[model samples]
Target: MRRPTIKDVAADCGVSKATVSLVLRDSPQVGQVTKQRVRESMARLGYVYNRRAADMRSQRSQTLGLVVTHLRNPYFAELTMAIEDAATKSGYTLFQGFSRDEVPQQRRLLETMAEHRIDGLILLPAHDSRPEDLLETVGAGQLAHVLITRSVRGYECDYVGADNVRSGVLLGEHLGALEVSTVAFLGGAEGSSARRDRIEGLGSGLRRSGVTSPLALSLPAIGDEGGIPLVDRMLERIPCPDAIVAYNDMYAFGIMNGLRARGIVPGRDVAVASFDDVPDAAFQQPPLTSAAGHPEIVGAQATRLLLDRFEDPDRVPSTVLIEPELIPRSSTTSWSGRA
Candidate 1:
């Protein structure tokens, strides 16, 4: 018995092999009805795509290389999974790496992927990645790349993330509604674009509500381990602060733990809020008040952007900032400012 090929699928569906190839690549150029017919023909005829052979002929690997700066944070974990699901469903392969928010390590991993001929790259920039560093390392025209969550030195490229500033605004409004006048914004590093936008949004919201400027406390970056020590440092400021707005829900969880260690009860003694309503945010000791980044949506959108760039590399770059939603819960909304 002989194996059925892309040509067989094309013939069965009465379309040009070029069209069949596009369908196999999940190219958006093909119409839905035709896509369905081609898919059905492939299934019926048991046609298998020779991706490796195709790669050899085209000199392009059908693989996307992904580097997420932090992996232990469940938010990034969820985001990575979403990208994987979208990539697999679209018939592309992915190679994922964690840079642990280190610039040299991220550059090394990305260079290694490029050396292997990865067709594209998806990156969550490290704490100190310059746009020029990336273009220099990978070569501007070498691969179709997309920036996710954080942009690098404001260089234009396919990018997607929750509106951080808007999310900060959402958190501030929630705190103001709770009559919080002096909250401390905790966690994200000083120079992160995401953190800057968040601080801007939060400041704007707090000021509009007659609240004073928030104590902008900085951490090293967004990850698993900085919340407790950072929040402790925030406690040393002149004013004890009305509430705490963490960089993300993971940090909020740590703040809650830290508060408990200090013989203070969160949500009752001081309110708490943060961004990225990751799944665990709700199930915390007291459900968290947070802004939803919709990692699932943002992740899917990032994947589509990269895949589209693969299909049409010359298209103008796009930046998609998904709006965030505030989830008010016991951790902040119910705080009475005393335990």
Candidate 2:
């Protein structure tokens, strides 16, 4: 029996061969409805796209690689999905790797992707990553690359990330307005640039609001489980802080749980705010107040930057910093400072 081809799919969908080709490539030129119809036809006819043959003819793999710090973090998960969506629209397949914020693991992932010959790469640098780690593959231009979420020290590379300092300032100002005398920052890795920037901005905002000093603590781990023990330690301090700012929503959620275990109410007794207003932030027990990092924007922009790099390899590298918005919620409201 003869094998199904693009022509057979085109004829079945009542579209031109060119149109069928466009659909196969997932071109933006094709309307969604038409793409859906063409896909249906292809499925019904068992038409398979010969991507390898296409790559051979184009001398390109039409694939992009993405390496994220932590997929368990909701923010990175959403960011990855957004990048995939953008890549698919541009006729590129996206390959993903999670480094778990380990420099060695991240380096391994980059080499593996280069071995696979992906056309481009987008990376969220792991904690404590140095420029040398990326200079070999990404800096040497073996593959087009864009850095997202975090940038490596001394690496002059294209980057897209949230304006973390501004996000921290916003959160700090919000907490200050509540007339809280003391603030404690919890969670996140100590080596993370984003964490440092957030702390700086938080302290600046707190000082501007007449709050003298802010306490900061970096957890060995950053998720909810790690956050549970943090509350007790903070409470042990002289005149326990009146509010808490978490590195991310997960920390805030865990801290809230810890607070409840000790019969401390979140909003009324001690306000809680966090960064990365992930999907679950709103539905938490007291609806967390958080900075909307907009991971989708970061992901989409990172993909766009990488695509542009492919078009003009010699163009000057660029950096994009998306400003964050504060989402006020029940968790940070109705605060009555400690007695």
Model number with the top lDDT: 2
- lDDT of all predictions, in order shown? 0.81, 0.83
Taking the tens digit of each residue's C-alpha lDDT, what string does model 2 give over 162-268?
99999998988888788777778888887788888888888888877777765544333443246788887776754446888988898888899999998988888
Question: Model 2 Cα RMSD, Å?
Answer: 8.6
Write the residue-wise lDDT of candidate 1 on 110-216 in tens digits. Answer: 88998888878889988678878788766464678888899877577888999998898888777777777677778886668888888889988887776775554
In candidate 1, stretches whose alpha carbon ends up further than 4 angstroms from where it belongs are 1-58, 139-141, 216-225
Residue 125 accuracy (lDDT) in model 2: 90
Compute each candidate's TM-score over C-alphas: 0.83, 0.81
Q: Return the top candidate by TM-score.
A: 1
TM-score of 1: 0.83
